[model samples]
Target chain A: MTASKDKEEISTYKTQPAEILAIRDLTDDTRYFKLRCKDITMNKDFQYRPGQFVIFSLPGVGEATFSLSSTPTRRDFIEFGIRKVGSFTEALFKLKKGDTIDIRGPYGDGFEMEDLRGRDLIIVSGGLGAVPLRSVLLYIEDRREEYNKVFFLNGARSPKDMLYKRDFIAMNQRQIIDTHLAVDEDDTGEWPYNVGFVTQLIPKLGELIDSENTTAIICGPPIMYKFVIQELLKLNIPKDQILMTLERRMKCGQGHCGHCAVGGRYTCLEGPVFTYYDVQHIKELI
Target chain B: MSKEKFPEFVELIKSKGKLFGPVKQKEKYSFEEIKDFSELDFDYQRTIISPKKFITPAKYSTLRFVKFGQTEVLPDDEPQIVMGVHPCDIHAIKILDRLFLGNIKDPYYAKRRENLIIIGHSCLPDDKCVCQSTGTDMVEDGFDLFLTELDDFYLLWVGSDKGLGIAIEAENLLEENVSEEEIQEYVRWQQERSSMFTTSIPSYKYLADIIHLNYDSDVWEQFGEKCLSCGTCSLVCPTCNCFHVDDKIMMNAEEGIRERMLDSCTLPYYSMVAGNHDFRPDRTARLKLYYTHKLKEYIGRWGQPSCVGCGRCIAYCPVDINVITVSNALFEEVCETQEVCDQ
Candidate 1:
């Protein structure tokens, strides 16, 4: 019987205490939060890949999902780019720098960094989608030599709404990887990047991208997928090579909660990141 | 065991733990606390809710939060015996066990499950019972004790060590040996029960494929239009385990408890993420998720559909829409009324 196995069993629902280390505003609505496990052992041992997420439980409020906005290469502390959208995030936005919250899991199948080691990469993001893709870009930056030519295309509503604007500007200044930033309408006349959708930037990669060798990673609003995917397909990128991270209502980061189910697959289990080929047949997937 | 000795055996089992069995309440049947053996109405086809409620209550506290941190709140370790469970309901419990006890075990569910002792009883099929098609009509195991009632006595089959201990303790009231004639009679009873099934989901094996083929079918819109979204189907379903969690603060405001409650996909916000993006915004989409998850997706993952064909949806759905009507509509392209398609 499983009764004897109970002693060694760690409940999936069990959460660890995490204290806010730092907080900074990326935009009026979105903020960058850095948190570390209060328990030294847990903080030291915790490791997660890019594109995975954690469930932030705010006792007396509710629990919400947040993608890991930091890279695994960086040890101890984890970060999230949270937008004040709902009551949970509203409460989350109120907490100060030293406040503690319950956090569990480094769940979901994140980006496969090792697999894309030798491949050319095209990282794309728009709006809050940059939160998870930021982890991927930073990971590649840390291990720049392992991968081939890398191109980043980011878009936001405007200059003021852009998440991690300073970081992208700094990366662009570094000039090690090709970085292209765009905004729908730049309210700040001083904004240096292109003034259109991110999809428009894909054409500039015309001769630079080796279609067969390149793995395109995209994360953005639902509307961005159609036009962006069209551009990527025009470049002849294989369906399986085009990976996009998705968002769904998730309570438990584990597959126990059925909210994140897309067709037969649980987005929290099989993916929050899925290959275009994987979900092409699933009608409900957006 | 003889019919007269059954009451004495029940008394012995009641001493073991809190014994619960099927009891009649007004016009409906439910699994309630059995104060006496007479309260057990095993003649009924099904209960309003399966034994799942005992395992995962509609609502329970998972974590209790204080000033600094939170503590896990597990169900009390009181041993409970739920008797008179039908085979299909037992199968449903087994499915719940596999989900809640398999990889990434739910601690709360695990605790409640460990404290439960299942005692199944044989039941005859009614017009609504479709377990024959779902293949959950008979259960060989997953129960501590199973009683198959005969003409004048009961053939008690012990399935576990706990049941064996009970048999040993009640040996004074139990018949140790049975005749070859009685064995033949039991076989005859099994055949008669098998022939009694009048309901089945035809071409059950192809339901998954058909559901996929009809993903864009208008039949969903028709059903969704009638759906009340009351979530009664999921509540009555033995296998529906989706839940929503909330945090409730006490009046003092210093302490609170995180509560887990049963949630249905048909509900308004089952698939709504923060920022209010509802993946399944309309009734049609949500209704599709409910049926597809149970009928098609479960088969892909577990090699069997989650619907045990206990027929709770058929009996309880206020609207005339159910697995039978929906499946028939998809399979035969027929509706309950001719005007349904014409309109």
Candidate 2:
């Protein structure tokens, strides 16, 4: 079978140890994690784009996919904003600071930052969608001179349910990017931003920038896609310029596992980030 | 090799390693370890399961772990010779090799594949066989040795160095030269076998386009209504290599072993996420994925359909949903008159 000298095989399934440097609660059910590779050499060499994800293996509990909430500009540590939703998350929540876990990848076709350079950018995130968008937001913030006008619109169910409240408020205070925060309802009445759906903020952008030079990146709940895309289209933003990150149940982050397959593509390989023009024909894609 | 010398050739193969061949049990044929040459049966049209079970397996432990440390459990490194594989199954194995042994090599599958040797046997088509349509009726390679049975002798084609080694070992039993009459006889046998195929998908070449055009057709729902969701099609198919992994904990809660087993896309919750979100919630969508992935999507990725037309899905599906019926329905776009769409 060994007919010719074969290229070195890339071990897709192998994982390295990543120790938890810190763990902080983002909300009642969600937590923000900061981790670094246990090996010093691996820690320095680890590189990933904003929209990529990692597979967190808990050994006996099995493995699950999580997005990298931290940007690559911050090379010291990797982060994930995980919600306690299922059995895997339930076990993950029990782990304390300084604990170690098995992680692999940086998989998926993340956002092409270089492609979006010099283009007017609008980043819209809602609920837990902020997790992945946070990475992109921080990436843009570090290299603010590369892009044109940048806008960050974030939404949550209420004040208490919002993730990264402190960090976003600080960014809003800095006035570097046009940061807009919206709450579905201001139950506490202490909210300082708009008290309606985040889709309402989309119209405010109509008068600020030229739609032809603009690119909109959105990540939100399944229901938010229809309204957000409709508003973006009304503003004359091109369909191909409208990018979104998606979620799917994945075991192997590589293309081997069929769990993330949609139509003819795999979410773990071809996507997690797709243009509206690319998936508009797919009926199953939201 | 003549018919009388076949037993002696079999003995030579047995001396190499553990040999497995098709055997009849309970009126069904399966590949089982051969204890004696008399137990070998080569007349079967198809086995219950394809030869994929020998490589990927239905279930196997991938990693054994304690509380803090883990180690990969590689398959044992013993030479294995599988005899009597057909052309369609050989094509299916090639498809698997492309997926598992391609850019990202699966260590477990690679090890098992390297250790196993293939010995192919020619087959005549039955009513359910559609290999002729799928273009997998004849395998040019992917086997150590290929045997085409003539009237009085077995014309052995050495496909690899391993096969050449075996041919060298049993040189006395093999005919050194092909006679003029024997060459004509082999050509005639090939022509006769080619004409025996009774089932075919006429528009198989354009199946990818046809399936894409009819993605929203009602034919899938009709098939879905009758499907039991028992995952029998995937278990029997040679190219269906999707797997689900589970971690088994010890009774003491100290250690566990992660096991991977064959999974089917048509089964419930095949695309479900952690937060109870199911991408393919209903049977119709899941069933559509199964056919589209094999017949349409595979072509886009691999330049050919993954279905080699072994007829296992035709023989095994309780609801009569097979590649032939599904492809024809999509191609014609007329499922209203079929038995499935009548309801």
Candidate 3:
């Protein structure tokens, strides 16, 4: 009972340092920051379920919630695929290694991996939505023997905006996960990947088309979600099996802020990842 | 347990400090000082708003920040008791309690809640009241003392030890050893008077199940047309605790205070982001969420509806778009029309 009480209290008061371990520029507007917990013991024990996000803060500058790109198994470090679109992210992009920041997290109901055991997994990501899905993919790879089949389809504005380049190549070479990448437009002589919308690849991925035990996880911009869900439904995936991650402007990672709520459900509490059937009727989610 | 000694109770509170009760202000009523026993208006259906304003005022500073090296913290304040709160308003206070005292407990609200004492009054409902529908007509907890008014005296139920102490201190005012027959008479009188009050909605449980069934129900569009988005309904609501934090700097740049003010979902900017994305961009969606959260989500999570049916929303609304009317319309739609609902 005391352990459960502590677990319940975990979501309330949280304080962790945000020491930057590594930084890599993904695009002109996006950067990947690898944050290592300053306290080694805290870092080793910091566990997060996939699809959960953390509130990243730069002192004096504001804080914003970002989906963790790192898998829970990798406790030594956590990563964030931040797009420099808002004031907070823009300021975050300027930070170098060894700079201190504030982090309070692993909040929200993450994807239920236990429920999907033995089922075929289909991951659909558009633009920078791959950040959260990356966590799920890594989790699956860590326990590869548990799942039946794995497939990944990612879409980006251009080849340059595509995240996790070396990681995608490594995953492809291992042949553990069937991976397909798509770009919106073809560069004159630079790129050689599939040049079309990400949803267009859904029909081509025969496993998702034929498998009845398939659970497709989708995360993207609002427009991307609508179009991708439409395509997945066309492919005859079960509504309850189709998981979609939602994005909202979150202040307090806790549900008290009321900033990230979609109708009755707080995106920060009930879900950032909700099955289509759960949110299908919630019109405001889209 | 017995008849309250009203005058002595008043004196006990007065000895502590000023005691606030319902005082008529011009045409509207507010929680103000009870100068004398005659000034107290127990018959008023509900105040223009809840007494939460005494704790978390409409606007107040929470934290003062100074760059003394690098640290930020809040300064505290004195506490007081609010007497004669209606049952519905007390229920609303309980809802705020859950929000503030839940997993992520808010220090600002907790500080005030811990120090304050609530003395609830049994409501005499008016035409617009639906406390029965929301199951908030009488409170079992969340108060130090609860009083049910009778002909010449008030039947007091002591809930907390503080209440017992207050009653004991006011020995001169109370008459002990009241007969069980008199207690039965008071209960019967309250029941008879309460039955006359109108219930805008039916059973709360049934209402919760079918409340959102009429999402596309034209009632929202109708309400939206009349709603000024002035947020009077949310502001006057006792359970509506949504707030926005802001920073204020004094004339001297050396010091600044961070404060949180009550915010309303009715405003277009309530859900607005930096990139100009407003989730509930439509007025209908905003209005629907307000009622759905109060009637459905709050009950679903806390096993009780957030609205106490104090009728402040009905009374304060510029166009009078009451929650009970909207909930009743949906209840009828779900039971009669057999329409599927949205979550």
Candidate 4:
């Protein structure tokens, strides 16, 4: 396997293999895997920022990009929260814990703490959307004093669908954090919290906005942005102040594929994350 | 630069590498491998397909995964001599050079480029050609040798050391005469070529700005209804370089080959995300994106429009959707008003 540090080797469609250290079912369709590089130094040197993505592949199956759910500060292993949506993910889901899989990337512009520092944060996410934000949340957890008040609003279909529940509980226990949960039309089982759209919780986050110092980081289903953005705008939040990550059909992860283009920008190159001010000009985005 | 002895140069280069030149297939001409020098026909109009496929193939095996999931890159190392390429097509290759060989070099494209030799010739403009207005009717570089017509003979312009080496080696076949009449003939051919353009743009400058102002223009929706979504325009373009990759696993599950193939934006599912969110869901949006990338976005970064104006997209389009016509419609309207104001 070539070193991930080589830009040419890493950027090519060619992939290096990684071993799955552990696998756990988060939901019926979604699975979480702990992957480590086959080479010990690669595992130690393999670093990625929050919101940066990797093009995970199932050799002879296909390739798809997913956000690095693990924080960059942790060097033991990298994690991905994947849902079996298509044939590629289907192949990945079938792999056992000991099985090895092909891997490439740590592509795209990621969320930076310097950009979000000195501001109170409100992270709005739903379902698997929380995966990338978990990186930022953990980074903030490491340096707690850089930010002011922090709020995390997560939504799921049911109690069974929630990911990293222990971390949510741990975050709620922290004196500096306020966590809220919501479920949309859950009928399969009991879900404790607000029982409507995730946008409904936006009004409940009072005094979290300081105008100049408050920044909102959002990631969710494409449709959730419709209502959530409206609520953020209702709070008189400048479009630039509201930051969100976008999901697109990313193939190259380096922008050459042109599969994930939104308007003039390649989501894999220019973003997977953008301020509302940046994406408002794109007519395709809601 | 005697026209009769040009076939000798072709024969000489054939010994160096695989020789390719334009050959008449039915009514159109295409770059095809040939052993005999007489097979080349420079009189035919345009090829149904651009020669872009020689570098970036339609489908290729990029890599193979072995037992431990390690990969081996499979690149085509064969050298080629591409002869009889048009100046417009030469411009298109330069555009591709900027994209693939720039900031992050695409290994697949770079390897092919290294093993290739380009010999270009000036072509007469057809009715659909907008190369004159697009400023791609002529090119200064990106070719080893460029031949321009001059009455009964041709003027050979060597662009690089490789071209000079070929010229030096083939000096016996080349005429070394200094005649004023022959030089005037070449200048006259240049002037004649300038008057052959049938389609002209009112303004090539500020074209990106024009597109920016008309982002919501209804003109795109009008063409959207007529577009069959066949994707022939992108397929025939010399500069369209978008591609997709897939890994094929055998039943053994331990090994598979990674394949790359050219992808078209006109396809319905080209931009579909995991949650079924497609940014360019409608035909209008897709066509707009196709035009925008060629005219606006490429210029913004690369300092020139990606479209060489070879008009292959216009020639091959099933629905008669011409990018030049659409751009002219946008520019002629605004430029008319501006000219009147200046008067």
Candidate 3 vs 4: which has more TM-score: 4
Better model by lDDT: candidate 2 vs candidate 3: 2
Shift in Å, residue B63, candidate 1:
1.0
Give DockQ: model 1: 0.63
Q: Please give, for residues B156-214, the per-residue lDDT of candidate 4 as tens digits.
A: 88898888888889899777775899888777888888898888665566688877767
lDDT string for model 3 (B51-157, tens) is 88866667766545554322344324554677888888887887887877887666656777777778888767788787877777778998988887777667777
Off by over 4 Å in 1: A1-10, B334-343
DockQ, candidate no. 3: 0.32
Model 3 CAPRI quality: acceptable
lDDT of the candidates, in the order given: 0.89, 0.89, 0.76, 0.80
Task: Order the candidates by TM-score, highest first.
Answer: 1, 2, 4, 3
- Give per-residue CA lDDT, model 1, range B1-343, as digits (tens): 9999999989999998899999989979999999898898888998999999999899999999987777889999998999999999999998888877777688889898988888889999999999999999999989999999999889998988888888899999988899898899999999999999999998577788778777888999999999999999999999999999999999999999999999999999899877888888999999999999999999888888998999999999999778899888887653332223332
TM-score of each: 0.96, 0.96, 0.89, 0.93
What digit string (tens of lDDT, one per residue) describes model 4 on residues A112-170?
77767788888899888888988888888887788888888888877777787667767
TM-score quality measure for candidate 3: 0.89
Per residue, candidate 2 scores C-alpha lDDT tens digits across B1-343 of 8989999998999988889999999999999998799999999899999999999999999889997799888999998889999999999999999988876688889899998889999888999999999999999999999998888999999999999999999999999998999999999999999999889998788788777778888888898898888899999999999989899999989999999899999999998887888888899999999999999889888899999999999999998999999988786783443333332
What digit string (tens of lDDT, one per residue) describes model 2 on residues A1-286?
Answer: 0001232233446778999999999999999999999988878878788898888888899999999999889997999999999999999999999899888777788999989999999999999999999999999999999999999999999999999999999999998889999999999989998899999999999999789999999998888998999999999999999999999878776677688888789898788999999988888887
Please state the error at residue B250 of candidate 2 in Å.
1.4
Candidate 4 chain B has its poorest 10 consecutive residues by lDDT at B334-343
- The best candidate by DockQ is 1
